[model samples]
Each structure stands twice: as structure tokens, then as C-alpha cells.
Target: MTRIFSLTCLYILFLLSSCSIINWEVEPDNLKITYQDEELSEIFHDHILRFIDEAEKRDMTFRSGKVNIKWGPELANHVNATTFSNGIIKVNPSSVKINHDHLSLQLISHELYHLLCQPPSAYDHRSRHLISGTPYVSSLMVASSKKGEFPTIDNVEMWEYYFDELFLHHGDYSFVYDYESNSK
Candidate 1:
């Protein structure tokens, strides 16, 4: 029993220490938006703002800083509508203009969540964009627990993203709360 307890304590200590390395802390209010093509700027900005409002309603504070939004010819030909903590969200304008049944919003919203709260590792992030987002989603719970993330922002965001991602998958738009209900 003593040996097992000692081993458990050591493992816990190691887990706690490792968590600090993978976390990329960025304030939610520091997010910024800049447009490569001035024309599509407003459109993308509106979408981003909509996401922010939705997140806030859920008590998530993803920042509102100056994020560089690249689209149109300025957008990379082979980019996957990426979002980074560096305040940049790049998307193909063609995809936005012809969203093909509102798929673009789904894609952008997913990336927005990624930017708002990053995955634990670069590899995990890459894997998330693949055809199978489920595997990665399941991994979030285990990975976060392994890292021993306590009551931190990263931990909270991880939970929020986990549930939100699931909600996104089922085409549910009931996340927004009724403000008037609070008055009652």
C-alpha cells in the first residue's frame, strides 16, 4: 500500500508539471482582426463577431483583438481556413462566397473555437481537422486529465470546446440563451 501511494504521488507531481508546457495562454480580449482583401473583411468580421457573441453567452471570453483575415487572392491556395493565437484567420474567399449550404460557417466556427482555445499539441490540432474529428474529440478528455489541468482557463475551455464541438456536429443551434428568460 505504501509503495503504491508513493508511486501515485510521484505520478501526480509529474502530471502537474507537464501541463504547464503545453498550455498556450492568450487573453480572450486581445484577439484582433485585419483583412488582406478589404472587400471580404466586413463579411468575415460579422461571422467572427457572431461567434464571439455566442461564446460569450455561454460564458466564454474569446478575445476581440486585431486578427488578420486573409481571403480572396491573398488567401493561400492550399490553406484549410486556419486560425492561430497570433491573431490570424485565413480562409479562401471562394469558399465564403459560395458556402455550399452554409458549410463555410461551420468550418469557420470550428476554427474560431480552435483559436479561442487551442488543442494541447500541434499534432492533436492537425489531427482534429481530418475527416475523423471524433477520435481527436475523445482524446481531449484523456489528454487533459493526463496533463492534470486544474481549475484553469485552459481546462474550462477544453470542456467548453468538447461539448460545443459535439453540439456543432448535430446541427443544433440552441446554444444561445434567451435573455428575457433571465428576467423572470
Candidate 2:
């Protein structure tokens, strides 16, 4: 009887722990992409493919939903991109120009991270204070960026670090609340 109880407890614990584990495999066939500009569509599709490859390598799990990407009008508040909890991502092409391919990738990756992680509002953006002090210095989820702010497109190390932080540290929101506290 004791042996049975121990085994049942272990089984319950395993089931509970597995619930928190994310399944990182992504099916591209599950995604439905739409865009208004041909050039932007190509860039967007390439970014999504690259994101899937990277996610697979890391075995990162994203929330399960059919992703819908579409071109949106110029966003209010100077925002270039926005994501919805329902797996919709809208990018303002006028704000994210084709010449700025690196910026486009950054925006797309940032939005994708939001969709995949479903992080609370506290983790929405990496705080500037945290960025200055941590290995997450070049996090793509920085609240804002200038036209030429992104690293060169071929900077493998930087890109790798950004994705690593996005997938590996998505749950760490240490100093994020500190910023809120101080602001208030």
C-alpha cells in the first residue's frame, strides 16, 4: 500500500510538472499569413521561417493558436507593430520600411516573442535599467527603437543572443516591476 501511494504521488508530480513545459515544435502549415506589400510579404515570410528554425533549435514552446499576420495602417502612438492574444500580429508597413530589413526582423521577432511567451504586461518590454546591467543588452523587445537602431543583418552573435534571451529567459521579470515601482 505504501509503495502504491509513493508511485501515485510521483505520477501526480510528474503530471503537474509537465503542464508547465512548453512544446516548441511549430507547424508552418498552421500559420495563415496576409500582407499588402509584396516586398514586405517576402521579408515577413522569411522572418517567420527563420523564427521557426530558431524556435525548433531551442525547443521553445509557443501558445497554441492559428497565427494571423496582416499589414495594418500606421499605428497610433508611433508604434510599429502590435500583437493580440488571439494570435494576430499587425505591422504598420509605412512605419517599418523595406530598406530597414533588420528593423523589420526585429519587430517581427519581438511580436512573435509576445505571442509565443504570452508574458504578462510586466515582461512586455525589457527595462532599460535591466538592459544596461544584463546579458540581455540587445533584447529585441526593447520598448522602442530608432530607424537605424538594430544591429547589422549579418551579426550572427547578436541575433543569437537576442533569440536566446527571448526563449530561455522569457519568464524572468526581475527588475521589470522595479521600474513600475519607481515610476509611481
Q: What does candidate 1's lDDT look like per residue over 1-184, in tens digits?
A: 9999999999999999997664344444445656786665545556556566555555555433455766534656544465666766777665533233223334555566666554424313322221122222231212122112212223444445444543342222232122113313
lDDT of 2 by residue, 20-51 (tens): 67444445344455555576577688887787
| Residue runs of model 2 more than 4 Å from their true location after superposition | 1-39, 119-123, 129-137, 171-184
Which residue pairs clash in candidate 2? 24-60
Q: Which candidate achieves the best lDDT against the true structure? A: 2
Question: What overall lDDT goes with each candidate model?
Answer: 0.47, 0.67
TM-scores for all candidates: the values are: 0.45, 0.66
What lDDT does candidate 1 reach at residue 172? 26
Report residue 6 deviation for candidate 1 (angstroms).
Answer: 35
Alpha-carbon shift of residue 53 in model 1 (angstroms): 0.5
Model 1: lowest-lDDT 10 consecutive positions: 141-150
